[model samples]
Target: MASSFAYDILSNKIETRSAKAGVIGLGYVGLPLAIAIARSGFAVTGFDIDPKKIVSLDAQHSYIDAVANDDLATEMDGGRFSATTDFAGLAACDVIVICVPTPLTKHRDPDLSFVEATSRSIAEHLRAGQLVVLESTTYPGTTDDVVKVILEKTGLKSGTDFFVGFSPEREDPGNQHYHTATIPKVVAGDGPQALALMKGFYGAVVKTVVPVSSNATAEAVKLTENIFRSVNIALVNELKTVYAAMGVDVWEVIEAAKTKPFGYMPFYPGPGLGGHCIPIDPFYLTWKSREYELPTRFIELAGEINSAMPRYVVGKLAEALDMRSGKALSRSRVLVLGLAYKKNVADIRESPSLRLMEIIEERGGKADYHDPHVGEIPSTREYQHLKGRKSVDLTQELLDACDAVLVATDHDNLDYALIANSARLIVDTRNVFARLRLSADHIVKA
Candidate 1:
């Protein structure tokens, strides 16, 4: 079959909402995307390696906060959505989307293992007239050089026998203002035909589709967005430390500075960078830059400053414990607040809270945590010893029992007033108590 004929068939299927869509790795990005695609009138089959997720979807239960049970049930009932663990189902779908993780290795280099594995799996069932889009965040040339090469190994040429594109996911978990469909998608493809198919398909689901020149540009778009954030956040984290030494509140400065409205944008400081993107994405570019022998000094500096935050916050905790409570950190009982990277979200991927706990324990301090959103610490690669620890109840007795409270993540649902009245000493990394107008003599901002 000619490439134009295959493109026409897939393009028609996308236009008439007759396309059978398959989404792989149905976790944070995939599940919501699959739901949105299905809601746009396509029959979407979600794929994942986890049987538990398959079972959960089968029972109309939603593991992600953005996806509600009622909405999931409605989709399932309407026969628009289903999930499975079978890669062979890919052969039956006209549009296959990959939404897998692209994590960093221990040395802070790009780990394309997940993306490579997913591409190989798709290649196993790849056929003509199908459009495969990669929504994973990666370095430039990944879609064209890495994923395209893997798929073409099956003797089918992209933009001919099949179409290939890149549309990096801009998933902001727990953001009230934006969801999968509301966020504008940046799409690019191997060729003009593939680009048109990408725009046509994504245009049906999202509110807007931003068509870029090539797959590399789209990949660069995701990296730039994250790198900009990482850099600005590093600046604030540095300023936070500097202002703390001068006894000036960094939060107040940010509040006043953001009021300018024209020139300034606010990026708040936390214990450290967290979630999947800001902490890891900039490093993808930094690692790639090394291949060309170009320097990424600014990016590397930001990463270093952000990476050292847990230790910095822990140092303040120790100082607060010693000065305010007249106790050594080794003998103190510390309550680390919020396990999630950000507030009100249960995602702990690359969260600095894990690092804070590890540092506290390494210093011989007893570390316990309390998060309203996270019930128990899940298994993570870096923090194996901290795994399985349960979130402690936020009772007055529990607060009083602790020597100090370290506010790593300021979840909205937590009782700030109770913490103010009960805890003997508080090291406020998030400045939550001040934001809520609850102040006490013992509260110290880190």
Candidate 2:
């Protein structure tokens, strides 16, 4: 009876678009989700610990690329969206979504500190008739084990007093074709009432809501998606090494192999895996599987291959410099082109370009970078020393001064023609020059 009454109140609010939604951790995932909920007619309060983000949002400025300034202005101007740092306001919200970071610790273990901390804050203001959903990617049991355990500590039963659900966030930062609203959302809950509320809430916000059997199933769905990519990418990266030895171009091989169209999907090789998902998500499962005494050999192997790519690219760069210019890398200057993990956006989470730069500097080489998207390097857990470094101006004079120009990221806006014409030696890791049909002796494929 308690569950039914609580469900009725929240369900009606969701249906009528009167439910106040609170999204915690306004970042690449939380910010866009908050805007989407606001756009769908819900009054949304965005909660973040960062005061700078609050200041930016108050000024109608957007830090994420997917959200435009005009859209933010429209939402704020309409009084549908607001940002704050206070947890007391959380008590007023009917629905609370957790979208905090779930990064791995230094030991490659699951770091649930952000999620746990967010849960504790919510628990401080948690009340009856409120729904809490976790969108941070993690192991299958996190929704039930970590989040639910923390929330239930308030002496309130989960299904009867409140609700719990899991819906993994599938955010692609630079994807032009897909956005928060268009992507299909996979949702699951702790019980029937929770599931109904999840379906009602997410159904109104996104285009499609896929209901799964359990919260753990929804969690596994996200892990599987990223693991599939990680394994395939490792396969290609290993193939690149084997094919390079036999005078075979892995890019050409992938371009032709993809022509089959029926049995194959192409995954390209890079300096290494970047972004928050591929490099990190697979390890969440690897860490969880240890409880069951299972060996995730394939996933571990894929991680090794992807992690080794930066060093491999550096080795190739050293080889190219010695063969082409007869100069050892220790006494040479190299310009790294592009800094963001992928092309066209300014997301640098777990970017391999940082590792490449670190390795270059460790080997006694002077390294500088130029990125159109990233103006300066921000503080990161792994690459703290590279912080405050600014992007250099890409000019003929700058290019001419370097011993070798290493192509790390393949952004479309870069002046490849200027690079081909000006740089004395080019070691292409992304095949950007060949893709443009530009041929020169100085440009060597790594």
| Per-prediction TM-score | 0.99, 0.99
Q: In model 1, what are the clashing residue pairs, if there are any?
A: none
> Against the true structure, whose lDDT is highest?
2
Query: What TM-score, to 2 decimals, does candidate 1 have?
Result: 0.99
lDDT (10s digit) by residue, model 2, range 132-203: 999999999999999999999999889988999999999999999999999999999998889999999999
Error of 2 at 201 (Å): 0.5
Q: Alpha-carbon error at 413 in model 1, in Å?
A: 0.9
Every candidate's lDDT: 0.94, 0.95
- The Cα RMSD of model 1 versus the native structure comes to 1.2
lDDT, candidate 1, residue 274?
94
Clashing pairs in 2: none
